[model samples]
Target: MIEFKNVVKKYDNNITATNNISVKIKPGEFVYVVGPSGAGKSTFIKMMYREEAPTSGSIIVNEYALENIKSREIPFLRRELGIVFQDFKLLPRLTVFENIAYALQVIEKTPEEVEQRVSRVLDLVGLSAKRDNFPAELSGGEQQRVAIARAIANEPSILIADEPTGNLDPETAEGIMEILEQVNKQGTTVVMATHNSFIVNEYKHRVLEINGGKIIRDEEEGVYSNEDANA
Candidate 1:
């Protein structure tokens, strides 16, 4: 579960990325965040993951208040959340298995435990065959799947995907969505940020639309509702 209370994020020169935004996401729910460019969608996701601190207001994720979370405690907070991004942030030299295993290794997990967890998540993302491959060898979709596997390897309670399918073709994007849906079905709360209207229309779910740094609309089973012709 995630909750934001009167959250505000401002960059230098008084530019507000998020303006007094407040929202809540319940456990076992899947939600889509929709917005135009510069509408604060990225800032919102960063707040949830503690990548960007709110200038004001409070953020509570998986029961820990992040507004004032100590730097030393951030690792513990992140242990309970999974994060995926538009760019597949995989290390070029690391094999797919090693890439996923590195997350556990950082937390000082035993070698045996790391191997077991990496194996399970790679299987979950259907990338078992590519375990020894590097990121450059895989297709775009395959690379993203590997990224998802790495994120979920630790079994985080919440998953935050920021424009996860932004680089893939429609068919490949659909495949990634299926994996996310399956993950959500298995009880991990999923919050995804995307601008793809086709995917939005195809996989209808709760949508929160942001505009001008504020929540413009919140709808259950909603489609992309941007009024701009170019959107």
Candidate 2:
């Protein structure tokens, strides 16, 4: 589970990216983070993985107190989390399998274990047939599928995606959404930050609406709109 208490992140120029934010995302929960551009959504998610440090307050992720965790401990903490982005972020030169295997290889997972996990995730994402393809050889949707496979390649407890569907067509985005939903069902906590209201309305989840670095609304079965979000 992830919990934040009275968190605030202010940059050197005195602009506060997150202002006294707090929330909890339970294990196995699928949540959508919605708001306009620069609403602090990305900053909020980044803090969970220690990609950005908080100037004040506490962020507890799967029992790791990010506020006090040592730098040496970050890699261990990251193992519990998976991250994907708007851009596919794949290594263009690496094959789909190699891209995913790199994550485990860095952590020194045994070759057998790495091969087993990579094969499983590739099949899970319906990309087993394309395992040997490089990023340039695939379609956009296929590339994203490979990205998703690489992200969960390690069986992370929480998966964070930022604007995952930003570059995909609606049909393709829906495919990605379905894959994410399936991942959630199998027990990974999913937190996605997106601007697609259509997708937001189609899939009801715990919605957190943030604006001006403040969480203005937290709702179960939340829909997307500017009514409360643009404030």
**Tens digits of per-residue lDDT for model 2 on 25-60?**
999999999998888999998998999999999999
**In candidate 1, where is summed lDDT lowest over 10 consecutive residues?**
222-231
Model 2 lDDT, residue 21, Cα? 95
Q: Which candidate is the best by TM-score?
A: 2
> For residues 44-154, what per-residue lDDT tens digits would candidate 1 score against the true structure?
999998999999999999788999999998989999889998898999999999999999999899999999999988888898999999999999999999999999988
Decoy 2 TM-score against native: 0.97
Best by lDDT: 2
Query: Each candidate: how many clashes?
Result: 0, 0
Where is model 2 poorest over a 10-residue stretch in terms of lDDT?
222-231
Q: What ranges in model 1 sit over 4 Å off? A: 225-231
For model 2, what is the alpha-carbon lDDT of residue 211?
91
